[model samples]
Target chain A: DQQVKQNSPSLSVQEGRISILNCDYTNSMFDYFLWYKKYPAEGPTFLISISSIKDKNEDGRFTVFLNKSAKHLSLHIVPSQPGDSAVYFCAASGTNAGNMLTFGGGTRLMVKP
Target chain B: GAGVSQSPSNKVTEKGKDVELRCDPISGHTALYWYRQSLGQGLEFLIYFQGNSAPDKSGLPSDRFSAERTGGSVSTLTIQRTQQEDSAVYLCASSLDVGTAVYEQYFGPGTRLTVT
Candidate 1:
């Protein structure tokens, strides 16, 4: 079963616009959530993360908002650039899982210049 | 300051053949994880190892699939009599530890395996 899900497979937006990526989870045990960006033929790199206790966390141009009650989380990239085009995967881990990250199917973001 | 590294970036083996993939975790990192991404699918956790701790094999798909971590550094994943469905990109990742704090994992470029 897929505990984490990214419903949107692909998203397109104009450069300098805002890009929003959404993820949902069914496992309440997950307490830490993270986002990773990946380019073709490369490994995913960590972007940002949020704890279950917090609702939002921001770094630079990327922001992650979490809603515990809705079991939903989202990543927002402000002033999206063409370099932001890649597959973004959301992952989650719980204390019980021993740092094993369960990842979503990933959403491909395309920023058109 | 090297990140996780996996060997044999690409492998194409025939069905019924056995293949072994290797992974070298970042230096001094005590936690190692193995995951695979199949076509049009998300990453799937396969196994995990921590400093002398019993490896977690809960995610191994079958008895044919197994992994071993030697000297608490490098890891090897072996698939025996592999089927065509075993084709996927196997990824390795490492972190400082698996303590209470959530440590961000660094992943390797991954080893792509294709069973022909």
Candidate 2:
């Protein structure tokens, strides 16, 4: 029984275009959501995060939107560049459970030139 | 000034063997965690340790998997009677604390274990 889920396994977008990655969770207790970017042979690094209180959060070209009622969230990156090509994972943490972050499978994003 | 370091970046071992993976976390960080990532599988929690409290081992898959943290700094994950199913990339991370509603988790280069 996976709590967090990333329905898409792979996504491709043209450079300078917008890339959208989606994720959903079954656990209603999840309050804090985060996105991680991973490169081959490297660990997943924290990219951005949003609290349940807010519906959206944005940093530079990266924006994260959360729909608590639907238990869905999406990450939007505008003007996607080649350097953005990597595996992106969605994770969530709650207050009840030891603040442990449960991660989704991940979506491989390929920005084509 | 190191984020996190793991020894033996890659290891290949035969089935029924035993192996140990080490992790060194950042200084003054009292929280440490172990997670495993199989091919096409999401990262799974293995264990977690804080300052002297009972570790949350609920995530451990089985008894064959065990870990220990010394002085709340370094940690070692030991797997006994390794099985082919155990092959995966083991990752270690450290945070300030758990259950604090914090989203910052620092990770280290994982140790790829291949069991034949």
Candidate 3:
């Protein structure tokens, strides 16, 4: 059972434009959510994260928005750059668990110039 | 200092063989995790070690897959009698603590294991 799910398999955005990737989760117990960027043949790098108590958290050009009621979260990249093109995976953590992250299938983002 | 690093960038082994993958975590990071990545599937948790605490092997797929952490720093994941489906990129990560916003897990390039 995939607790975290990214419905979109892929997304395309124009350079310098805004890009939005959406993710959903089935478990309401998750308290912390994070987004990671992964390149080909490389490990995923942490981008940003948000807590359930907060609705949004921003870091540089990346912002994560969380809606507890909807069990939905989104990662927004402003002025999307070509370098930002990679697979984006959404992960979650709960207080009960010892921070054993649960990751989604990931969404492939492509930025076109 | 340097981030997490994994050895044996690529390994090709025959079926029914045994393979060992290694991971060196970052300095001062007590929490270590192992994950398996397969095509179309995201990171699958394999095992984790935290300080002197008992390791969590709940995510391990089967009895054939096992891991160990020595001196609470480096870890080794061993797969015995591996099947073709066991072929996947094995990734290792290190974090500061558990269930905290400080979960900025630094990851390694990963060891690509191909079971023929």
Candidate 4:
């Protein structure tokens, strides 16, 4: 069974628009959530993270919103640019689970110029 | 300032042949992890090693897979007998430690292994 899930396989957005990617998790023990961006053939790079204590975290054009009650989270990118095109992965980790992260399948984001 | 590094970016071998993949973590980092990504699938945790503690091998799919970390810096994953189903990209990551508030993991370019 997958503990973390990304329902959307891909998303497309126009430049200067907003792009939203969603993820869901079944494990209630997960307290820390993170998002990573990956380019083709490259390793994933950490983007942003949120603790279960906070409902939202933002950095520049990227924002992550978490709904603990619903076990869902969404990443929002405003003024999306062509450089933002890549695969986005959502990962979660429990405090007691050491440093192991459970990752969602991932959503491919394409920002059209 | 080097991140994690992996060797033999791509490998192809016949079925039943054994293969070894290597990973070198960042200097001074005490935690290392291995994962496998199948086509169109999320990463599957393979193993983890922290300091001098026992390595976690719970995620190994079967007895054919194994890994070892030497001096807590470099790790090698070995497959006793390769199978076509074993074709996938193996990823390595490392963190400073496991007890930190921000358990950020830095990853290395994966090694793509193909068993024919």
A74-99: candidate 3 lDDT, tens digit per residue: 99999999999999999998766557
> Best candidate per TM-score, number?
1
- Rate residue B90 of model 4 by lDDT: 96
At residue A26, what lDDT does model 2 achieve?
96
Model 1 lDDT tens row, A43-104: 89999999999999999999999999999999999999999999999999988766889999
Tens-place lDDT per residue, model 4, A1-113, is 89999999999999999999999999988899999999989888999999999999999999999999999999999989999999999999876765688999999999999
lDDT of 4 by residue, B1-116 (tens): 99999988999999999999999999998989999999999888999898999998999999999999999899999998899999999999998774656488889999999999
Indicate the TM-score of model 2: 0.97
Q: What DockQ do the predictions score, one after another?
A: 0.87, 0.78, 0.69, 0.71
Model 1 chain B weakest lDDT span, ten residues long: B95-104
* Residue B96 displacement (Å), model 1: 1.3
TM-score of 4: 0.98
Residues A1-113, model 2: lDDT tens digits: 89999999999999999999999999988899999999999988989999999999999999999999999999999989999999999999877756778999999999999
**B1-116: candidate 3 lDDT, tens digit per residue:** 89999989999999999999999999999999999899788999889888889999999999999999999899999999989999999999998874444477889999999988
For model 3 chain B, the run of ten residues with the poorest summed lDDT? B97-106
| TM-score-based ranking | 1, 4, 3, 2
Which candidate order results from sorting by DockQ in descending order? 1, 2, 4, 3
RMSD values for the candidates in order, in angstroms, are: 0.8, 1.1, 1.2, 1.0
Q: What TM-score would every model get versus the actual structure? A: 0.98, 0.97, 0.97, 0.98
Candidate 4 — which residues are off by over 4 angstroms?
A: B98-102
Worst-scoring 10-residue span by lDDT in model 3 chain A: A93-102
Report lDDT per candidate: 0.95, 0.91, 0.92, 0.93
